[model samples]
Target: MTTENKGIVQRALAGLIETGDVNTLASFLSDDFLHHRSDATTSTKAEWLAAVHAALGPTAGMQVEILHLLADTDHVVVHSRRRLPDAGPEIVVVDVLRVADGLIAEVWEIIEPVAQTAVNAAWWEPARL
Candidate 1:
């Protein structure tokens, strides 16, 4: 069975950034899912997929390194680092998700550019534990 926790979101996001496979990613999101990013002015899933595809079109690969994950009655928080094959690595994003019926329905995100105060680590490290 598919896991119904934040891992599902992370895996979906990973597939999007790494492979630009919006179809695979879309299956994991609710029809009303909210999407946010570092530079987003809108939150539509189509826009989100478009942006991911645009970025991956030039970059060779992408990766999301989740730093933290917190869950409650209806939500999950994922702090992550997004890396590009050409740009190297750094801590980049923190995402908050509201889930319903095992699907992500809402999201709020914070994106930080590479900074001295941030630390880069494995995505599955603390986020899974």
Candidate 2:
């Protein structure tokens, strides 16, 4: 079940990135899905899908690279980097998804913009021995 949950999320994310099809992405989500953002705001399935469509509909060159994926029981965690069409700084995102009955029921996401100048190394960078 853990593998299945991971596969479901991977496929959903792949579908969104590859085709930018909100409808296809919607198929993987439950009707009562809720999205919890890092801003302390939450969105329902409809609102979330609408935002996704608005964001992806115009960004044909947007890219998302998955950095790591881990699954335990019904939860799947994904760490990824997104480069939007605006050519701005890349954003690092970590999404935790709860899969229920083969569909994504809830999602919690944290986003951070990459800094051009930083005092320390990026958290995602490989550490030197």
Candidate 3:
């Protein structure tokens, strides 16, 4: 059952990013869900939905890649990747989630910027110090 929940949770998150469908996402979330962002800010379910709407702007093109998944009872952890409309690709995003009463009740994430050595090594003149 936990495995099924994990799959459901992951799919819901993916759908949220893909379609910017707040309603669909909300159905799977607890009202008091605790969300810990990769940037370290915590928010409730309402806040998260608002943030997604703001980020979507007039065009929605965000994409999510689920690299791996692990489930332990009501807890689900995922290593994932996301691509934003105007942002470069990043890697190593870890999301920890808790599901209760058939809804996602808590979530935490850690994200890291992808090291772009090629871009970094490009010849771009730095400002005079």
Candidate 4:
């Protein structure tokens, strides 16, 4: 079911980088998985993990909210929000990923810092996912 596949992607986004979970996260992605970021930077799965580890430290914790998650046979779009420890700013991210054989093969993501006080967290939200 597409929704079930979407659930997998959602869980990956939430728990991928946490302690004792990176390997499980890897299993959800293809070896050639690529991530395209809003900053115009791109990275492979390993590179991404290394980058996050560097930025947030080896043992960073985060809180995630799956605001929206939508999927089809080949792709899923997740609008998720996260707040990290050693806190910088609240971030709202929209990740559009292509899934193949039940694994994420490619992703295009946009991340924005939520204002201290804002009416809507994201740029915009679809009526329904």
Candidate 5:
């Protein structure tokens, strides 16, 4: 079910940050997996792993906190916030993923700096209506 796919994403994030081993995520990703980033960059599984390695500096030392997760059929969306150790401000990330055969086939992610004054709002919020 879609909820299980959300768990897959959770596991993948934890695996990536905890183990820093791309192969640890094999159970979650399909061989043809594709990741689409906020910058509009698209990459295959290998390419994405390479990028992750470079960005996270080999060990990929990081931690993630899930703020929200939503699943609709084959689509899963996750919103998380995390901060590097004394390095920079907190970063908020929104990841949208598509799962097939119980594995992630595609992903799109939006990353942004969390503004100190920014308040979380929902589209259906009464004030926004």
Candidate 6:
């Protein structure tokens, strides 16, 4: 079930990136899906879809590179890097999705802009014990 849930999220994200079709993305969501943003705002399925379309439509030229996927029985967390069309600094986005009955029922997302300065250890380096 955990693996299945992860796959469901992976496929949904891939579909959105590949086709840029809101309907395709909609197919993976539950009818009563809700999206909770980092800003403390929540959006319904329809509202989220509309937002996605307006922000990341085909011509937006946004690219998403998934960095990590972690899942349990009913939740999947995806950490990714997003590059917008303007070629500005990359953004890191983490979405935690709750899956029920093979569809995504809810999502909580956080987004942060990549820092230009060296603040800490390199992201690619393995943690030291």
lDDT of 4 by residue, 83-126 (tens): 87777678888889898887889999887778733545433657
lDDT of 1 by residue, 11-113 (tens): 7777765666777777877887778665766578777657656655435466666677776667788787777677665546777887788777777877766
Model 3, 1-80: lDDT tens digits are 78887887877777776677777888888889888986779998888778766654336665667788889888999887
TM-score to true structure, per model: 0.66, 0.85, 0.74, 0.74, 0.75, 0.86
Clash number for model 4? 0
Ranking by lDDT: 6, 2, 5, 3, 4, 1
- Residue-level lDDT of model 5, residues 44-98, one tens digit each, is 9989877767545445555567788889889999898877655767788888999
Residue lDDT tens for model 6, 1-94: 9999999998998889887887888999999999999889999999999999876778777888899999999999999898878876788899
Model 2 has an lDDT value of: 0.88
Between which residue pairs do clashes occur in model 2? none
lDDT of 1 at 20: 69
* Model 2 residue 104 CA deviation in Å: 0.1
lDDT of 4: 0.76
- Segments of candidate 6 deviating more than 4 angstroms: 116-129
TM for candidate 2 is 0.85
Q: Who is ahead in TM-score, 2 or 3?
A: 2
Residue 67 local lDDT, model 6? 95
Backbone clashes in model 4, listed as residue pairs: none
Off by over 4 Å in 4: 14-20, 53-58, 116-129
Give residue 81's error in model 5 in angstroms. Answer: 0.6
Tell me how far the alpha carbon of residue 54 in candidate 6 is from the true structure, in angstroms, after superposition: 1.9
- For candidate 2, write residues 22-100 as lDDT tens digits: 8889999999999999789999999999988876654556678999999999999999988877676788889999999
Clash pairs, model 3 backbone: none
